[model samples]
Target: MKIFEAMAGLMTDLTAIGKDQKNVQQGFKYRGIDQVYNALHPLLAKHKIFTTPEVLDKTREERTNAKGTVLAFVTMRIKYTFWTDDGSSVSCTVEGEGMDSGDKASNKAMAIAHKYALLQTFCIPTEDMDDPDAQVHEIAPRAKPRVSDQQVEQLRKALTVAGMDEAQWCASVKIPSLESLPEEKFGGAMDYIKKAALAA
Candidate 1:
């Protein structure tokens, strides 16, 4: 994976774990970016690579609906500069397309964008990063409710099957706790559950 992709993947994985209310803020979790950046340090050390990924371009491309709710999308241009172990480097540009101007894409988006950016290959000296004063702002943005309608639309089908029509499905249905279910029961139980789904 490209440096940007690897970093983004790390951020995505960390963000996934913080979806609970313990991380919620103004419709988002706070400090997720810092957490992602911290996670990146060890990975970077292991990968033997360095990168500088930054926002290169941003534009709002969205249309408001009749209901007064704005459904805006963002076209973010990312620039990723990569350095290799053997004193070589390169710069790449990647585009990130999100749902709206302010709608943050998933951690997967970040990772994929980074990968696309680093697809370019050239060469630069590793010594160029010797500047002690230069600091890398490694972090994911603050966690936010940035999931897209498409994902929700898709999830509607799954949630219906899970009998999660209401947000509090845990209280609505009593099933064997996932932990109590034997590992071997997973496949058969899932198949049975799928077939038993009620019409929504």
Candidate 2:
């Protein structure tokens, strides 16, 4: 896929939880390397492509701007190698910098760094093997991630089950999770349901 194509593909069907919610209340920053990888997994599978993630190098130093603002800067280089099913040697390797100013926006900026990275890898277009000058280039900035309700519900359930109160379940009590949305998706809820059914 060309650079824009890959970025567009991810933008088109990317699914994340708590990444962006300006549209709702529960919207928050969800940062995870696996989350981004998972979003790209299906696209890779459908398009006969795959990726290998690796950490390349890191550096920490003091950078000062013309405005005389000095800050401790950390730059992380993460590589995402895209591959084809037949292993014909098709891939896009991108390098992006992650910055932090010790503020709330820094949190969001770091998240975007992940999105930017995966998107850029997707954007690096394919080229004819004979064309030596067909390398992809950088593009533009992106907004925060857009998560779906289904993903949110799934996360809620996962968290609840991992930290469920077994005593409450033995007493046949309802655990509404942190949001009290519903117990339908929670696995703990099902555990008790099976117990009750066996008791009958």
Candidate 3:
């Protein structure tokens, strides 16, 4: 039989576990990594399916607000491969992101990547017990910022005065080009241009 058929057969007898309370934060309950492993391990062993994850790449960006609060965002590209006992295998690559306020950002991002990879590929289901006090944390995403012609020209002039070209300026701001600069990073770009103007 095919690997996916085998995995589907194994999932038939599996059941979901409750949300982990030990690591709940901000009124939101999250399933821990251990819980996922505990549920999947026995089934995998019994079916002779080997699951492995390889991290293809990872990237991180950090921004600090005026009040000294640091926010970290990390993204990872991961490949999950499932091998059957009969020399058949399948693989999937997934991207996962995690955000945190401190030093554990990378670890959190990796854990999220692994959790999702397994969850999606195996189609695992979790317990549906309801929590009356469970808080739903949701925020609308901000619209992308726009840059005006005047702002772009001003930045160009600043670059010329600083004896630097657009490529150099873009590199300083960690962007591809001045026109492609995101609206959220406008303040930082302006700060960098002002410093360059002074140094010129």
- CA lDDT for candidate 2: 0.50
Clashing pairs in 2: 2-125, 3-123, 3-124, 3-125
What lDDT tens digits, residue by residue, belong to model 2 across residues 1-200?
35345445555655433342232446534435555566677776555555565656656666676777765666556566655545543344444454444543334434455566665554422221223477676878764343346644554454355564444542444433333434344455455445554555
Clashing pairs in 1: 33-140, 72-100, 72-101, 73-100, 89-124
The digit string of per-residue lDDT tens for model 1 on 1-200 reads 35555445433433221222233335643223344345445655666568878887777666776777676666677787766566565577788665532555434346556644432231111222234577677798764343344543444455576675434432343433333333344455445445657533
Highest TM-score among the candidates is held by which one?
3
Candidate 3, residues 38-150: lDDT per residue as tens digits?
Answer: 88888888877887888899899997867788889889998988889777888889888887787888788888888877777776766754545796878899767767777
Stretch of 10 with least lDDT, candidate 2? 123-132
In model 3, the number of clashes is: 0
> Candidate 3 has what TM-score?
0.58
lDDT (0 to 1) per candidate: 0.51, 0.50, 0.79
Q: 4 in model 2: Cα distance from truth in Å?
A: 14
